[model samples]
Target: MRTFWGLMRAYWFSDRWREAWTLTIVIAVLTTLLSKAGVWLALMIGELTYSINFYHDAANTSPLRTTLTSGVLVIVLFVLKDAVIAGTRSLVSATLHRKWRGWLNSQFNEALLDGNHTHFHAQHGSADSGAAAPDNIDQRIQESIKGMTGGAIGLAMGLLGVATSLYFVGENLLQTSVEVKGLEFLGSYGSSVLALLAVATYVPINTWIAVRLGKAMERLNVRLQQAEGSYRSELTTFLRRSFHVAASRAEDVQKTMHNRLYGDIDRTWARLIVVTVGYNAFEAVHNFLGYRIIAYAPGLVSFIHNKLDLKGYVTGAEMINQLIGQCSWLIHVMPDIATLRANSQRVTELANAIENVQQPQEFYSQSGRSDFHYASQNPVFGLTIQKLELAHQGEDATPFLSAANLRFRRGEWTFLRGESGCGKTSLIKAINGLWPYGRGTIVFPDGVKSFYAAQEVKLPQVSLKQLVCLPGSEQDYGDAQVASALHKAGLGDFIEHMADESREGKIWDQMLSGGQKQKLVVARIVLQQPGLLFLDEATGALDPDGKIAFHQAIKDNCPDVTVISIMHEAVAPRSASGDEFYHSVVAIADGVATKKPLVPNLPRELTTILTQPRPVEDKWMRFSRRLKQK
Candidate 1:
């Protein structure tokens, strides 16, 4: 309960608090007013029924006139009541859904992106470390947000309606007394007593059943979401890799996995439906029996009989009985309330997970030294790691990287080489402050801009121009500049085709090959020209010549940029006629990084090229040289 309220406070006090609060208050006030009006209308209709049945002929007013007037009023009241409810519900629900989703999505995304990326992924794999992180996070973000918003609105309105209904209806039933002259049991208090008795008997039973059903449903809902998410995730994977699957002739294997996942979903859904149907059916029968008990109570019947005998009508007792029968409606809505609670629990769980992910924790210390500190000085340009050891959270026994000390000078190219699983990428993560499970002081030159291009490229589904100028506006670079960079990265043909089609906005990933994607990443580096760039197998997809061209372009185009690349093999500067592109090589073995100079052996021609001074040419001079050669 505390956690639930905390989640509510977190949302309500978020950046959009004013708008959220205003909408909530307006919806609550409107719902309360409409509910009270509805109760009043119901009570008035009951009184009118009694009058028409028992006192119509005795009154001076004509029976037909009174009946017609009351009928019209009833119709108007019902129509107005329903209209108010529908309009308020639609307006409130739509507004809240949009606002709440936007806020929640932003918060979740910020937490995921801005926090420790390595820690986040580690938690997903290890339950002990990050037990609070939700599974199928994509589904949780999408579906849970919808459920939380809609369920919260419905639960609030339903409770308000129930409260108002009880207040008005219960008061009417309690005030109207009934007496039987010949009966010694339950005289004037019969209606009130029976109403209270029925409620007292049924509420606990209804609540117990509702709670049990709610728990079962919550468990099933979790499983159902997991199954659905798994199926969708697998489907996306298969579609993305359809060509590969076909070429490998593993269609049968993929199809079998798909069928098995879908079967799990189908079976889970069937069980959920069966349980839901059974619960509803049972509730219906339970409500009928509860209502019948009050309606046919001996006290109620005796009072009605005596009233009919004395006054030639039993309108008072009949009205009271009708009001008492309304108690069953509360019982009927118990399941909905339970479902709401379950949904709230799910939302609370997600909120907690997000909170856990975003909260800061003390950094893990491996060197047992706290003497290292970073000073905030001007013009930061390099990276320094001292005694840094990183391990996955809660896995101190097996360190990903251990006691590694390294320094990268400004404007120098360094290559990182290691066998598979030797923590080359993990070192990059540690340097970027995305891996928190390391004790070391990594001091970056103040105000240094760094960019990392991963092995598997993730191109957004946007225009080619947007993809190239990502994290920056396309307007920052003119089309001609973009075209020049693409050409440098060996995408001149792509630009020509795009120019013919007037490619204002188009997704290029589908049309591009693996080599092209790597080249595109290189194009991004060329365009952005950050102070420090980390490339993890960024050119692995490209052929040797293509790799050489990209490396030469980076060195030529952005001479001042520092490059740290992780690769399976060394990136030789042979393309530059052995003019030593990399200043040093850092090799990782058994969790330690040892720095070494470039390979000693080289061709005499390559060695001579390294000794020669190369002339630097501007872009225009290079262009003029190319024209002359042509």
Candidate 2:
């Protein structure tokens, strides 16, 4: 319930809180009125029955006038009651989808994207297993959140209305005395009191048993949701990597993986079925016991026939059944409550994981660095790396780099040159506050907007202009600005397709080639015009000439942009003519970063030479590496 409230309180008190409260009050008042109206309609049936009985008597022949009037009124009340029910259903449903569920969907969706469309904390599980995002956030947003609103809010309000209506309708149950054959003292008590006593005793036991069975179902539902999410996630993965699977001819391997995923769902679903059957069987027997217990009270039939009129007896019977239904509400919805708990728990788990990921903690016992705190007021150096170490993310992994220092002067384009698997991306992420595995400070300049263009470019299904201007409103940037950015990034051919918005899934993804996708992202960075930009091998898909043009375009358009390009040495190479076109290089090797003057950085050779730091004559004696003959 604590976890349940964590999800509710967010949207309940959100910006639409005023609308939320208004709708809540409207539903409550309408529900209460509807319940009262239902009670009135039930009583009107009794009055109608009395009128028919009155007309049946030969002594009172008024041409059935009173009976006809009563019948007409009963029909009107029935129609009105049903109409109100239909209207209320529409009203609540509209509010649920548009106001409550809609708002919640957008809220959690934004959270899932982490406001960057990055889905960093969402797709990647948190460091702590307990605080990780639950599998299949799509399932949470689509189905579970809907269930949460309906079950948590709608069910609660509905139960409240039922309870309120019972207070008035229960008056009919007092018309007769409940007398047990063996216990004649029961006759001294009104039927309502006896009914209440019976309910007070029996309901607790039934509810206790229902709850016990419900608990197992609750745990089962959580497992079921997880398995379903896992299965769905596999399908999504298969689709995303469909091209690779086809090209590599790994269909059999993928089929086996998919089989394993669905097999989990199948096993969990089987368990759920077993539990559901048992629960239903118990419910059937328990509900029968509860309903019959009051109906078969000793001497109740005699009391009804001898002491009450036809109307009184009929109304009493109806009210007694209604009372049972009202009292058994919790028992009836136990399965729903269990499912609701499971959905809300998954939502809360994702919420907790995102919260934890956003918090600044000890990345190492030594601590990790983020760009948030270490902002320098000076403009001379746009960004500074203060003794930052690089480490991969895992328990078995240790920092590969020793504390390394460097500075990026304002408007400088510095190449982050390193060998493959040399933690260049990790260093960039550490400096940009994305990585949480290394220690030291990243001195980000104050009031400087930053953009990171990753190696893999994904174009969302939207207009080319919108894609370029995304993470920012398309309204913010003019079409000309977007078109110019595209032209600058070697995507001049796409300018004609600026207005082409593909609403169909991944159409734009299919339309654009690999090089075009990379350029599209580059255009996005250029269109945004951030003061600081990190390009993590973003030009990998482009040819040598295209790469040269890509770099030149950024320099030309965003002249003062401080660019840190993490260059893969194999891809970028060591010549100015090709991808190695940067003037400065920060080469990371030998677990340290060195500020080298040119491309073809000689740090690896320098470190090798420095390790032989013995006197020339006794070098062989001091270090085994410098053996005389060898």
Candidate 3:
């Protein structure tokens, strides 16, 4: 019950609460008045019949006027009661549906921003459970809220009607000596002698069944939801893996999933069927016994005129009105109570996860002064490691990189060279504060900002201008300035074509090649021009000539910014004579960056270049085939 009210409190204070509450009160009053009027009409009909017997063989003119008036009043009350009820339900449904949608959207956005989103995958496996959102959440918010709110309001009104009807019927019965069998207490002032026995026999039994059955149904719903999510995920995977599963022979996998899903559905439905049958049978027997107790008392009288009648029509009408109100209230509330239980469990799970404490040794400590920067004379950039460790599955730690502490200065270029899977990319991510499963303290100046590009950059389904803005606004740059930045990164062609494009930008990610995407990322760097820049193989896809040109552009545009890049084989290619065709290629082995000359006399080659084995590839493919004819 506490869980039920906690979940519903949000709606109680919403804008629609005042209007909804007003309508509920109005509907309750009308329902009670109508129930009373119905009992009066029934009593009038019985009296009119008795009057005809007393004055037979004449025109029945005296009671006709009262009968006609009671009939008209009954029709008017019934119509108004139904109309108000229907209108209140419609308004509540609309308000709850809209509120739930907004709440779910807000939760999704906060989860993404507050948590370490990229690193979360490394620790938490995947958030790809099929029961996540737009399905389970959709049902909870839409169907669940309606059931809960309506049920609460209906129950309160129903109980009020039942209590009032019981009072009036008991009071009127005490005025006569005619004894009611199931209500022997009606013979006294404070009636309870027989009414107490009937209520005590069934009230507890009914309440226990209602609560226990509702809990079981809630469990069944959760299992059914899990089955649906699993089935849908499997179907989607099958379609993506092969377009023609029938021809490619994936029948066995599909059949296996079908059998599993079918089994779950059968178990859930079977449990629900058993409970439903038991409850309805019990209710039917209970109602029958209650009516028999009342009717048999008059039949048992043995005197010549012993049968005592105190308007059986009035008693029956009142009982039926109270029964309908109680049943309606229970039926409306059953779904809400079940939904509130499930939602409460989910919220408690999330709260526990967020409140978990972190260990003291789990986080690295800061040792140096408050603002120890990378460019300071005795520069110790955060925490540097003598050796870094990583372990494979069930294996011991393997040393990835080992080196003495090295100094980094502001406005200096530092290049890391390594083969694929040699931990170069991981190092860059560690420095930029993304992947934290390593031994290092990448300390930054307290207030300085940095920009970095990983191997795979994600662009939300947004426009080109928005992608290049990078932690800032697109409106901050003029059209001419955006064009200039694109030109420097060798992506001017794409920008010119996409200038007047629609905002959707879905194909922009796929229509552009790897090199084109990297160029756009670099354009963002030129626009923001952060204090530090980190690149994880950012220019790996560009040709040898394009690589050299990109390096020159970065040096010219942002001379004061410190830049770091991971070096790979595609940096610059060389000619057969070992002279070189471009510059900036380097060879790194055993954790040292040794520069290798890839081109002849391309600025600073005499001082910065070192010797290394040349990377070989077919050279004749560089020229066009059409040139051979000329």
Output the number of the TM-score-best candidate. 2
Please give the TM-score that candidate 1 achieves against the real structure. Answer: 0.82
- Give the least accurate 10-residue stretch of model 1, judged by summed lDDT: 362-371
Top-scoring candidate (lDDT): 2
In terms of lDDT, model 1 sits at 0.66
Poorest lDDT segment (10 consecutive residues) of candidate 2: 363-372
lDDT of each: 0.66, 0.70, 0.50
Q: How does residue 283 of candidate 3 score in lDDT?
A: 56
Cα-based lDDT at residue 523, candidate 2: 88
Superior by lDDT: candidate 1 or candidate 3: 1
Model 1: residues with Cα > 4 Å off, grouped in runs: 47-61, 115-125, 130-132, 180-190, 290-299, 308-342, 359-381, 390-404, 436-438, 475-483, 492-506, 570-573, 576-578, 599-601, 604-630
lDDT of 2 at 601: 48
Error of 1 at 418 (Å): 3.1
- Cα lDDT of model 1 by residue, 283-373, tens digit: 7776566545544453455445654332212333333344444444444555555555555666566656555544333222321211234
| Each prediction's TM-score versus the true structure | 0.82, 0.84, 0.63
Instruction: Quote the lDDT for 518 in model 2.
Output: 84
Candidate 2 local lDDT, 1-630, one digit each (tens):
136666776666888878887877677777666666676676777777887777668776673787787788888877776686648855775675466778877876676566443356445554444444456777877878787777787566658766776776664455444443345565645555656666677777888998998899999999988888888888988898899999999999999998998888899889889989998998888778766656345226545446456676555555555566666777889899999888788777666655555544431222233223355657656788777766655555667975467888778777776667767787787776666565677788888889888988877777877888887888998889988898888788878878888524547888788888888877887788889988998888888767777787787778788888875543233334333345567766777777654434443333333333122445334455544445
For 94-117, candidate 3 gives per-residue lDDT tens digits of 454454435533443354345344
